[model samples]
Target: MSAHPENRAGLWVALASFVLWGLMPLYWHLLKVVPSLQIVAHRVIWSTLLVVAWLLWKQGRGWLRAALAQPRAAWMLALSGALIGFNWSLYIWAVNAGHVVESSLGYFINPLLNVVLGVAFLHERLRRAQWIAVALATAGVIWLTVQFGQPPWIAICLALSFALYGLLRKLVAIDAVGGLGVESVYLFLPALAVMVWGEAQGAGGFLPLGGAPGWGLGVDLLLVFGGALTALPLIGFAFAVRRVPLSVVGLLQYIAPTLQFLTGVFVFHEAFDRDRLIGFVFIWIGLAIFAIDGALRARRTGVTPVAAASEA
Candidate 1:
């Protein structure tokens, strides 16, 4: 049977968000000549301005006041913001430093990490398939570590930081946009400080300064629009998670990592030796098990996997 129109729309929106996320390496790669920290500062500064404007238009000043009125929520969001900021910087650095494959591996492991976090902190019970999936993913990490002769710190950090951020957000009861606005507020000062420091040190290139390689009108535009680029997919994702089954959303999340892996291997031509490929194969096996199990449970219970697929 055909699906409901709204469901179709939600699915499309979710797909778009993942696709954008998948292709983000290309965007960051353009600024490879620029400092990753500078890119991050621009991202935070402009994103704060844009998202706050959106909150003002949609929610007005009262919402901001309301969010700030709660001390615990404020602190939690501050922590989450720091985590995301670090994650963004690391991912940008990875993409530019020829670690896109490692960064993508982090994302590929994120959902499983989320599952582990849920079980540990939220006291949630996991099924047999979930246990196996987690086991397989753990094996992948071990294999990768053995093959690389060092732990994949980049991947581990990204997965853990983002997983924690998602966990905190799940605990908060606020609109996604408003929460992000508040988090950005917490992040804004530090980002601005970094920008100022960079400028003082003659390292800032947000604008053209005597024809620096990565400094020009084009770079300025990309840096300014980085905020929108960061916010749009998130906005789409928030809309999508609410409208679609979490299982479907969970399935779609792979699109981003898959695209990143392809870009790393095919487009950028990053090294992917057999050992590394074997490691990723294990992770893929785990993800397959996780997805299939969630789908079956969703079918049997006749309920959306919204709660189950919080692996996002």
Candidate 2:
């Protein structure tokens, strides 16, 4: 298929999105003083502010008022909000708790899981090569489980939670900004309550506190900075989705995980056992074949490239 301009744009945006996500562990590393929970709260609050600000900037006050008009939309986004919160909190915990490598593995496996979810819930069938990709990814996961003598619980949990979150989001009739705004709003109250509790316990986060604050405060600021960073790439991704084909976008997602994998092993000093080595080999091969297949299909069918259309 010929690439659409929007598709090309979205591909770049999505590419940027993964790159940022992959690099996030480093930012988390700076939060040595703030409790991980506090960091998450900051992410919620700051991200909420950033997105709402964008909505106001883009559509004026009416967007917020209009969003409130649809109770169903509100509810759907609320559910999605919870799922994302779980996903985000768990992810932050994983990275900070010395499971950065495992977290990367989760994302590497995510797109494949997304494919499976599409089949199970959306009734979309995979091509034969795509099935092989699934098989290879499954084997890689199984390898990790056996290596650990347990399920790859941390990684699997993150992937499944996010997959389910995306599924729920798909069921809703909301735009990216609108949906995220609702979800964050829903999350904010509870988050604020937690901060209040933390305050009572002398654990108030993201505020000016009295003690010689630890390095975690720096991390809190980073979290806020990340919230600002997060919005731009999503906006870019929304643009890209409309212009690119699914196959192209799908192929590009690997860039994020690939970087995470490298960061885990090289930067975080994560161990790569023999089993993981073999598993990675399988994943790499599977991806190569998957790409070839997707490319061939695009060539033969001449499907139009999808544009980045604004879903986060």
Candidate 3:
């Protein structure tokens, strides 16, 4: 409500990001004909191409050379690509494994992990409320682990991978689409390799996308859409980055995961027992404290709302 046009754009981008991510289960579901690995490979390959096209369109022919001229920059972006690839592959794998709900938990916990990352990587001092929030959330997760008598691996991996990915993205100043495009090149080779290998071994690539091998029209569409779908939120997020602050972006990271949680539980019918419930409660409390405290501090200091863009 307090958003300016620019700020509103950022919020819209964040919203778009969450909406697309929340609805991804439906997207992936349509791709049942595609192997998870193949689908992910396509995601890498095609998204790279799309990013490249966008970059070339925006900057003309010199973008790649300029980026490569700064090998350090190129490597950083390439590393970011790898990190995101891990994240994308893990997410696709998790979703296909009937672990979207658990993946939701991972994303929900990601904000807290971001906070931890900030403390570790950025030397940010936590407010008392923020500290309490972290403690509560930690307790909740510990309780869940104890309840399960095993690590919440799916949830933990998702949270950690994303947290690290966000950290890497922050180290650069590239536009989201451009940055992703650059990074896509890093994963392009591996993705292509996988596709070639799949076809060679007769593991069935994009061709068998339906009944027996292929996933069908819907799946093929999804694979293509995946590239566009990825590009959209990223552009939105890039808009937000210019409009917002890092701390604010951190607060906004909750949106996508929150939707994922609901989709996982009520819509997808994932089980949530007493411990898991309690864990979520603590996490919610932690996030609330963290957000409110950060907002107030940032407001006093006239910091922009950057947390929302942290997802990049």
Alpha-carbon RMSD of each model: 2.2, 2.9, 2.9
Encode model 1's per-residue lDDT on 1-312: one tens digit a residue.
018777778788889999999999999999887899999999999999999988888888787889877657888999999999999999999999999999999999999999999999999999999999999999999998898798899999999999999999888777677789999999999999998788767788766443344477798899998899999898888777767886677688899999999999999999999999899999999999999998788778765535533434
Residue lDDT tens for model 3, 9-125: 766676677678777876776676567888888888777788888889989998877766653677777777777888888888887777877788888778778889999999988
What is the TM-score of candidate 2?
Answer: 0.88
Which pairs of residues collide in candidate 1? none
Rank the models by TM-score, top first.
Answer: 1, 3, 2
Backbone clashes, candidate 2? 24
Using lDDT as the measure, the top candidate is 1
Residue 33 of model 1: what lDDT? 71
Question: Model 2 Cα displacement at 26 (Å)?
Answer: 1.1
Give the winner by TM-score. Answer: 1
**Cα displacement (Å) at residue 96, model 3:** 1.4
Using Cα atoms with residue i matched to residue i, what is each candidate's TM-score against the true structure? 0.94, 0.88, 0.89
Q: TM-score of the candidate numbered 1?
A: 0.94
Evaluated at residue 288, the lDDT of candidate 2 is 77
